[model samples]
Target: MHILILGAAGMVGRKLLARLAQDGQLGGTAVTRLTLHDVVAPEAPPVRVPVSLSASDFSAPGEAERLVAGRPDVIFHLAAIVSGEAEADFDKGYRINLDGTRQLFDAVRAIGEGYRPRLVFTSSIAVFGAPMPEPIGDEYLTAPLTSYGTQKAIGELLLSDYTRRGIFDGVGIRLPTICVRPGKPNKAASGFFSGIIREPLAGQEAVLPVSDSVRHWHASPRAAVGFLLHAATIDGARLGDRRNLTMPGVAVTVAEQIEALRRIAGDAVVARIRREPDPTIERIVAGWPRAFDARRATELGFTAEPDFETIIRAHIEDELGGRIAA
Candidate 1:
């Protein structure tokens, strides 16, 4: 099958690419061609798979058409302006996150007859605003606290409506805070979540922007990739009219994360972290969902990290080669 990945250069996109390249298949079916697109070119996999790379902003006029022209069997829409970046730059955020998504969906709608492709969109937990109950459920209302969340929630609504209209088979997976993400940080308010663990394991000092008691929902990069792969092949008929689902992830406090760190890498590694609260970050984080009752996703076969320790172990294995004594 032909697979197209947008924003293929980003961290999640790159990981998904690597996973696909290594497996050489999707949903147990052999992949024929892989088309990758991003504003920044992703690292070309040194694999024998037939892969093509393109550098183009999907929001650009005609770019979406070009991308959807071939009518790929699966399209992974992973491109977007992140939380802090989106809230910081309103124009850039709406331009890419909202308008860009619309362009892609429009392109899909304009396709010829019998073109029902699986459009797997990567949304975020930011879609839910504050004043929420302890654990958010699949039926939680979306009252985004930031422009970024609003954009994502809007995209989810669009995906649902479009799917209802039979324009395409779309699945919007509202992802949690991806912890222990590999590589450098992005502008997400949740970046510090990954930074604290990743940097400490790399033998570098990292800052914790909030109190240890700050609770949040989280998942591993491996789990996030699993969600994408599952969405790519899962039967949309099972999803019905609800095009979006809250993905399953571990819910823990920052204190638990530190405890998990001390357990896996000793107190010395945990000591690498310095506590310096940034109220700006804390305020933004306060509006996010503390936990999600993702029973729908769980029932649908979506799995998450067993605990904070599992999250860290997955990171150490995938990003640090199972060695953290550096």
Candidate 2:
């Protein structure tokens, strides 16, 4: 099957690409072609599958059409401006996140002749703002607190509506904040969640921008790629009309994350974290969901790290080659 991955250059996108290449299949079907698109050119991985790389803003006119012209069996829409960056730049955020998504969905719809692809969209838990229960469930209303959340929420509605119209088989996964992200940080509001762990593990001092008491949802990059793959193959009829579902995640406080790091790495590594609270980050994080019930997704066979330590360990194993700074 031919597969298309939007935002193929991002960390999660690259991981998904690697997993697909290693498995050589999607839902047991052999992957014959890989069409990767990103704002910047994605480095071609040394894989046997025939690959096509394109660098351009998909939100631009006619670009989305060119992407779906191949009629890939599965399309993974992982591209977005992220939370902090979206909130920082309103026009660019809406242009890329909201407008680009609509354009792509429309492009698929325009391809009639019974052309339907499994469109897996990466959404976020931020869709359900603060003023929520401890473990938010699937039935909760989507009252987003940030511009990024608003964009994703709109995309979710569009995905469902388009699917109902027989445009495409869509599945929206509301992802948690992926922690211990490898490489340098992007402008995501939750980047600090990974920063405090990633930087210190490399023997570098890291800032704690929020209070230790701050709690939030988290998942590992490995688990996230799994979610994308599963969504691509899961039966659409089983999902019924609710095409979007929150994926399972480990919920923990900032203090708990630090404790987990200390337990695994030792006192010196944990000591590298310095607390210098930033009000901007604190205010933004305040309106985010802390935990989730995710019973629907759990019943549907999605899984994640049970605890923060396992997430840390996964990062260490996958990115750090099972080794960290002393």
Candidate 3:
């Protein structure tokens, strides 16, 4: 099998690459070649399979065409402008998220007869807006309150329509906020969810932008990669007309996250979290979905960390080599 990964330089993308390289196969078939693309070239991993790396803007004219020319057996679309950045820069968000997605889909369709590949798109729970049910169900209508969410919702629609028309076998997974993200904090509005735990465990202070009672869905970085892989390999026939799925995740509040940190890393680490409310972030997060039913995804064999405690331990083991600051 040949595999193509967009946004290959990002955090989840990098982890997905490591998993693929380590296993050297997908869906029980050997991956003979891998293509990695992003705005900036990705560092080539030490994989036995032949690998190709490209740095280009897919939204730009002619670029998307070039990307799909190879007709990879599987394509994982993980590229998008993050929430805070998307909200701040409207044009860049729509251009990269909406226009770019259309460009890629069109390119695949233009390939003509009998050329369908399995396409896995990374969507977000941000696709659902406020006035949400406590545990948003699989049947909930997407009413995005933010530009990032709007783009992802539209992308989900496109994926469904294209799949229905047999252009490709597509699956869109609405991922939850990934906690204990290993890296410097980026501009994503949900960064604080991971920051509060990650920074404190590393003996650094982190700011909590939202209140203790503010609850949200979360999954570890490892679980995010698992969702991507499952989407790539799952039997699409069972999915029927609904090509998009809300992935399974644990729902916890800021206080619960802190308690989990305290349980695993001691009170000293928990003390590193300082409350500094940012109203803008709070407003953005308020519009985001706090929890999900995700029964559909769970039934389809996609899984996540059961609770915040397991999430924190996964971070410590995976990113910190199971060691924490004393």
Candidate 4:
């Protein structure tokens, strides 16, 4: 099987690439060729499979057409402007998030003669806005409060419509806030979700923007990669008309996350989390869905970490070299 990964330079995309490289296959078929594309050149990883790396803006005129020329069997679209960045810059967000996705989808459809490939899109839980139920269900409507969410919701719709038209087999997974994300914090409004746990575990002081009682859905980076793999290989026929799925995740509050950190890394690590509220971040986070039913994704065989503690432990083992600061 030939695979193409867009946004291969990002965190989730990088992890997905690593998993694919390590396994050397997808859906039980060996990946013979892999193409990695991003706005900036993605560093090529040494892999047994033949790999091609390119840097281009897919939203730009004619770029998407060039990307789909290779006719990959499986296409993973994981590119998008992050929440805070999207909210701050309107034109850049719409151009990259909305236009970029449409350009890619249209390019695929333009490729005639039964060239339908399995397309996996990484969406965000931010697609659902405020006034939401305690545990948002699979049936909840997409009422995005942020530009980033709006773009993802639009992409989900396009995926469904295109799939229904038999242009391609598409699956969109609405991922939860990935907790304990490795590396330094980025510009995402949700970065604090991971920062609170990741930084403190490194013996570095971290800021908590939201209150301790604020609840949200979370998954580990490991679980995020698993979701992508499952989406790529799952039987799309079972999805029916609704091609978008809210992935399974653990629901917990800030206090619960800190407790998990304390449990795994001791009180010293937990003490590093300083509560310094940022109204801007708090307002943005308040509009996000606190939890999710995700029964559809669960029944479809997608699973996540059961609790916040497991998420922290996974971070320690994977990124911290199986050790935390003493």
Candidate 5:
């Protein structure tokens, strides 16, 4: 199978590449080639298959066309600006998230002649807004509060319409905020969720930007990749008209997270998390959905960590090599 990964340079993108390279196959099929693209050229993964890397603004005229010209068997669309960045820059958010997504879908449709490939889009739970139910269900309305959520919600709608038209098989997974994200922080409003655990485990003081009472959904990066793989290989017809599904995750408050850190990593690591609220981040997070039922995703074989402690341990095992600050 031939695979193409957009946003191949980002943290999740890089992890996906490492996983594919390590496994040497995707969905039980041998990978024959890889086409990696991003705004900046993505580093070529050390895979046995032939690999091509491109760096360009895909939203620019004809750029998306060039990407789909090869008719890769599966396309993983992981590209987009983060929540904080998207909210702060309205024009940029629309251009990259909304316009860019539309362009890619149209480009694939233009490839007519029975050239329909599986498209796995990485959406976010931010697609749902505040004043929401405790465990948001598959039937819940997607009334997003932030520009990033709005863009992802629109993407979900487009994916459904295009799939209904037999243009391509698409599955949109609405991911919760990924905890214990490895690497320096990006501009996402949810950055603190990972920062509080990641920095402290690495022996650095980290800031807690929100209240302890604030609760939210979370999954480890490993689980996120598993969702992508399942989406790529699953029987799309089972999804019916609802091509988008909210992924499962552990739901907990800030206090629960800190307690989890204290449980596994000791009190000192937890102590490193200093409480210093940021009004801007708090406002943005307040609009996001807290927990999700995710019944359909679980029934369809998608899974995540059962609790926040598992999330922290997974990060330590995967990124920290079973080592932590003493």
Candidate 6:
């Protein structure tokens, strides 16, 4: 089978690529050809499959059209601006997140009759707004607070409509904040969640942007990839009119995270975290959902981290070669 991964150089994109490359398959489907696209071209996959790399902006006039010309068997759309960047730059956020998504949808719609490709989109829990009912369910209303959330919520609607029209089989996985992201921090307010754990494990100092009592939803990078794979393989007939589902995740407080750190690496690493709360971050995070029921995703067989300790260990194994030595 053929597969195309957009934003192929970003952190999640790279992890997905590495997972596919190492496994040499997705959901037991052998990938005969893989296409990687990003603003800057991505490196060739380490696998021996026929790999194509290209640099293409999703917002450019003809870019989306060109990217989908091959009509690969499956397409994983993982490109988007982070929450902080999107909130700070409204125009750039809409241009890429909204307009770019529309352009891709239009391109797929333009495909000839009987052309149906499996489209897997990576959305986020930001689709929900403040004053949220705790443990937001899959049926919860999507009243986004920020422009980034609005764009994603809008993307979900478009995907459902397009699939309804028989244009393509689409699945939108509303992802949780990925914990222990294996890279330098980005502009996302949730970056601190990963930063505090990832950096400290690397024997580096990291910042804590909110109070230790702050709690939120979380998933591991491995679980994120698993969601994509499941979305690609699952029977879309089971989705019916509701094409999007809130993903299962572990809910834990920042204090619990520090405790896990102390358990894993002792007091020295835990002390490396400095608490200097930023109200901007706190405000942004306050509106985000703390937990999700995710019953639909669970019923559909998507898995989640069992606990914070499991999440931290997955990060160590996947990102740090299974060693927390400082």
| Winner of 5 and 6 under lDDT | 5
Which parts of model 4 are misplaced by more than 4 Å? none
Query: TM-score for all predictions?
Result: 0.97, 0.99, 0.99, 0.98, 0.99, 0.97
1-326: candidate 3 lDDT, tens digit per residue: 98999999999999999999999999999999999999999989898878999999889999888988999999999999999999999999999999999999999999988799999999999999999888899999999999999999999999999999999999999999998899999989999999999999999999998899999999999999999999999999899999999999999988999998888889998989999999999999989999899999999999999899999999999999999987
Q: In candidate 3, which residue pairs clash?
A: none
Q: Write the per-residue lDDT of candidate 5 for residues 75-178, one digit (tens) a residue.
A: 99999999999999999999999999999999999999689999999999999997898889888999999999999999999999999999999999999899
lDDT of 1 by residue, 1-326 (tens): 89999989998899999999889899999888888999987778867767788997889999999988888899999999999999889999999999999999999999857998999999998999989987898888989999999999999999999989889899999999999888988899899999889999999999999989889999998999999999998988898898899999999999989999999999999999999999889889988888989999999989998899999999998888999965
Per-residue lDDT value at 313 in model 5:
96
Candidate 3 weakest ten by summed lDDT: 43-52
Error of 5 at 122 (Å): 0.8
lDDT of 1: 0.91
lDDT of 6 by residue, 124-145 (tens): 9999998888888777899999
Lowest summed lDDT over 10 consecutive residues: which window, candidate 6?
A: 317-326
**Per-residue lDDT of 1-326 in model 2, one digit per residue for the tens?**
99999999999999999998889988889999999999999978777878999999999999999999999989999999999999999999999999999999999988996799999999999899979987898789999999999999999999999999889999999999999899998899999999999999888999999999999999999999989989999999899999999999999999999999999999999999999989888999999999999999999989999999999999899888989898
State in Å the error of residue 6, model 6: 0.6
At residue 323, what lDDT does model 6 achieve? Answer: 84
Instruction: Give each model's whole-structure lDDT.
Output: 0.91, 0.95, 0.94, 0.92, 0.94, 0.90
Count of residue pairs whose backbone atoms collide, per candidate: 0, 0, 0, 0, 0, 0
Error of 6 at 261 (Å): 1.2
The runs of at least 3 residues in candidate 6 whose Cα sits more than 4 Å from the true structure, single-residue gaps closed, are: none
